[model samples]
Target: MSKESRKFHVPDALANLYDFANTLDLRHFTHHGIQHQQADELHNLAALGEWMRQHGLIERAAAPSQKTFEAALRLRAAVRDYLKCEPAERHRKPAVIGPLNAAMEAFALRVATIGKDGFALRPVTSDAQAGLSAIVAELYDAASAGTLGRLKMCAADECQRVFFDRSKPGTRRWCQSTLCGNREKTRTYRERHRHDPASEV
Candidate 1:
């Protein structure tokens, strides 16, 4: 669990998926005279391996190959694309779901007995790809538990950051109303009055 995940209060079950989906920060909006620089945590195989190890998804010595790195990038992109859609439309949108499903084919999980009566999803492999399967397992488990719907990408085009919607109505469009939401609202208000004669004076 990373600091960002904990700060956002993302549930433990979905933390990995949340973090993985947010590997690429698309927030390019300026705030308080500062521009938010976009960054991708998984910029390369070494970075991916470091991230996997940091998240305890893989062993410290486990290194991801170039192929695995490419697959991981695809998975991240597919996840972000899927999250960009409305929760209700996520399954219905083939343009998004197809790529996501295709990217997820590289990872696999299996049901395993946890304790007395509990069962949990475990990665089927022990190699570097297993770390990715762990992420897939999180997605599957969250979806089965219905918490997956709460995970969404910010509606702001400038800030396509993935966030967990904690609203009771679950209809939040922006990651933070005080920031992205307000910026959009302000922009819309300006556009609406842009051609108004009242402002011409």
Candidate 2:
């Protein structure tokens, strides 16, 4: 962690706190995320810091250390496991929150209200670890409040990237429609063709 990246800055209020919980976009060898998280990107602390900043987990001046980076990997693994559960199971007492709670406790956090209907979680210290924890805390708050409408894993078993369902009808089944969605659809088509007697090779 460098002072140049964490010494002075104001937290951006416009960022969606729940969004930070999705910092982990694990690589499945098929495609990259809206923010790439390839092995190289994740292994490098500086690149991890840059990704966090873009995702509103940390301010531009907030640098991440090796500890912060390692903690983040742990948190993401916990989250990814949690997302692998069925939706109904998740709504119940799935065994994933234990790790989530542990991850949330990594940093000190306080809820500060800006107005009658606006309050945000802030870290007690300027450390990048605090930023990571605060992001998880904010997500926990959102999930408990029922604001995280439809967080889901991709239907493609091999490409199990978790994503927030942003559809009007809430029918999104793939992490990315253009990529995984299309691939699955093409596979289905091939399967149908293989079964068709008239079109059989």
Best of the candidates, lDDT = 1
Candidate 1 local lDDT, residue 123: 80
Worst 10 residues of 1 by lDDT: 56-65
Clashing pairs in 1: none
Per-residue error (Å), model 2, residue 110: 2.5
Candidate 2, 92-194: lDDT as tens digits = 6547868866765666788878788998777787777766766566465656665444566788865776566667876688867988899799889999998
Q: Weakest 10 consecutive residues, lDDT, candidate 2?
A: 1-10
RMSD of each: 1.1, 7.0
Off by over 4 Å in 2: 1-40, 54-62, 192-201
lDDT of 1 by residue, 84-193 (tens): 98999999998998999999999888899999999998888789998899888888888999999999999999999999999999999999999999999999999989
Taking all chains together, each candidate's TM-score versus the true structure is: 0.97, 0.66
